[model samples]
Target: MAGKRGGTAAKERLSRDVIVASALALADAEGLDALTIRRLATDHGVTPMALYWHFKDKDLLLDGVVERVLEGVEIPSYPAGSQPEWHVRLLDCFAALLNALNEHREVADLVHRRFLGSTAGLDIAEFAFAALQEGGFGRTERAEIGVQALHNLVVLVTMEPGERALRDSEEEVARRIREKKVVLQSLAPERYPNIIDCAESLVDKPADEGRYRGLGLDILIEGIRARAARQLAEPAEKAS
Candidate 1:
C-alpha cells in the first residue's frame, strides 16, 4: 500500500515552483525548522531524491524562498513626463515592500539577509536609487540611505506587536496579551510611567496596523528628505 501511495504521489507532477511554494507555506505556518528536504518529500508523497532534484540543499532552498517573497514587491512607476515628488514615489516603493513582508513575516529575516542577492531585490533597489537621485543624493549617499531604509522597514515588520504570537491559537494569544498588559500595569508608575502609560499599546495588537506601519514609513521618508536637503546644502555652504 505504501509503495502504491508513493507511486501515486510521484505521478502528481511536482516542480521547482511547486516545491518552493509548499516550503513557503510550511515555513509560514509551522516556522522554518519544519522546512526540510525530507519533510517536503513526505508532503509531496515522493522520495527525498525528488526534492533534492529541485534544491540540492536547504540553503539553496532558502534562497528560492527569499526570491519568491521579494517578487511580490510592486516597484512603483510614474508617467515619463508626470513624475510625482521623489519622496512620494520612494514612500510607495517602501510601502509595497512592507506589505509583502508583513504578509509572510515568518520569512522576513531570510528576506532581509538575502534581499540583495535576488533579481527582484535588485529591481527594487534600482527603483529606489532612481528616486534618491531625483532628490539630489549621490551614489554613496543613495546606497547608504537605501540600505538603511530597507533594513528599518524589515525591523518594523519583525518587531510588530503580537508578531511572535502569530502561530498561537487566538484564545491563547489573547490570554497572553492580557497577562502582559497586567504585568506592565503592575510596574511602579513613578519609576516607569511611560511603560505603564503605553502598556495597552505595547501588549495588545495595534488597532490600526496600516496607520501604525504608515507612521513608521513616513518617519523613514522624512529622514531621507532631510538628509538629501543637507547634502545639497553642503556644497553651497563650502562655496561661501
Candidate 2:
C-alpha cells in the first residue's frame, strides 16, 4: 500500500495549464479571497514552490486565471462590406461579453478588481477600436468609448442577482422584485419625481435584466452619432 501510494504521488506532476485551471476551479468553488498559493499547493498535493514555479506571485496567478475565464468568451465579428451601424456592431460585441461575464460571476468580480491587460482583453479592445473607427470616432473618443463600455458591462454583471435565478422558483423571484419595488416607490416623490413616476418601469415584473444596459448603450451610441455628425459638419463648414 505504501509503495502504491508513492507511485501515485510520483505521477502527480504539475504543468502551468493544470495549475491555472486548478486555480480557476478553486476560485469558482470558493471565493477569490480563499485562493492562495498555499491552498493551491495543498489542493494539488504539491509544495508551495511547485506553484511558484508556475506563477511568481498571487497577481500573476490571478492574471492567468482571468485569462482562462476570458478564453471562453468570443468577441463578435462583423461581416465585411455590409455590416450594421458601428453602434449596432459595438452592442453585439458588448452583449456577447456581458453574457460571458454573467456566466462566470467570480471571474467577473476578478475582472472588476483588476483591469484585464491580458492578450484576450487586448484583442477585444482592438475589436472595439475598429468598431469605433468605423463609427467615425476620433482616437481619443474611441478609447473612451471602449473603456466605458467595459466599465458598464462589469457594473451590470456585478449588480445582477447572486446566482442564476432563471431556474429559481417564480414565487421567490416575485417576492424579491415586489420588495425592491416597494422601497423604490416609497421614496419621497417630491425629491424623486422620476423614480416615483417610473416605479413600474424601474422594477418591471419578470425583470428585464438587460433593460438598463440596452437603454444606456442606446444613449451612448446616439450621443456618439451626434458628435460624429457635428464633427463632419465642422470640417465641411471650415472648407466652405
Candidate 3:
C-alpha cells in the first residue's frame, strides 16, 4: 500500500504549468481572495513548500494566472497578401481577446494590468498594433488606441449585465431580475421615459451573448475606423 501510494505521488509530480492551471481554476470557481498558496497546496495534496518551489510568493502566482489567461487568446492570422481590411482584422483581434476574457471574467482586471508583462499578451498587442498601422494610425496614436481598446474590452467583460447573477441560484437570479425590472419600470415615465423603455434589457441577460459582445466590438472598431479615415485625410488637406 505504501509503495502504491508512493508511485501515485511520483506520477503527480508538480510543475509550474500544472500549478498555474490549478490556480486559475481555483480563481475562476472562487474569488481571487480565496486563491492562496496554502489552499493550492491543500488541493494538490502537497505541502505549501511544493507550491512555493514553483512560485516564490503570492504575487508571482497571480502573475502566472494572468499569463495563463492571456495565453488563451487566439490571434487571427492571414496568408501573406491575403489579409482582409484593417478594420476587419482589428475586429477579429479584439473579438478573440474579448472571448478570452469572457471565459475567465474573474481575472479580467488582472489581465488588464499585467497583459503586457506576458509574451502571449505582447503577441496579441503586436497583432493589434499592426492592424492599427495598416489603418493609418501614427506611432503616438497607435499607442493611445491600443491602450484604450484593451481597457474597453476589459470593461465589456467586467461590466457585463447578469454576470454576477450567474453565481446565484436560478430562482434567486430570476427574482432579482424581476425586482430590478419592476423598480426601473416604476419610475415616472414622464421624466424617465427611456429608463422605463429599457428596463427589461437592463435587468435581464442579453439574449445572445455573442451578439452583445459583437456590438461592443463594432462600436469600438467603427470609432477607430472613423478616426483613421480622418487622420488619413488630414495630411491631404494640409498639402492643399
Each model's C-alpha lDDT? Answer: 0.88, 0.74, 0.88
Model 3: residues with Cα > 4 Å off, grouped in runs: 1-12
Q: Residues 173-210, candidate 3, lDDT per residue (tens digit)?
A: 88888889889999999999999998888878788988
- If the candidates were sorted by their TM-score against the true structure, best first, what order would they fall in? 3, 1, 2
For model 1, the stretches where C-alpha displacement exceeds 4 angstroms are 1-12
Clashes of each: 0, 0, 0
Candidate 3: 10-residue stretch with minimal lDDT: 3-12
Q: Write the per-residue lDDT of candidate 1 for residues 202-240, one digit (tens) a residue.
A: 987778989989999999999998888898899999999
Candidate 3 to truth, TM: 0.90
lDDT (C-alpha) at residue 93 in model 2: 74
- Show pairs that collide, candidate 1: none
TM-score of each: 0.89, 0.72, 0.90
Candidate 1, TM-score vs. the true structure? 0.89
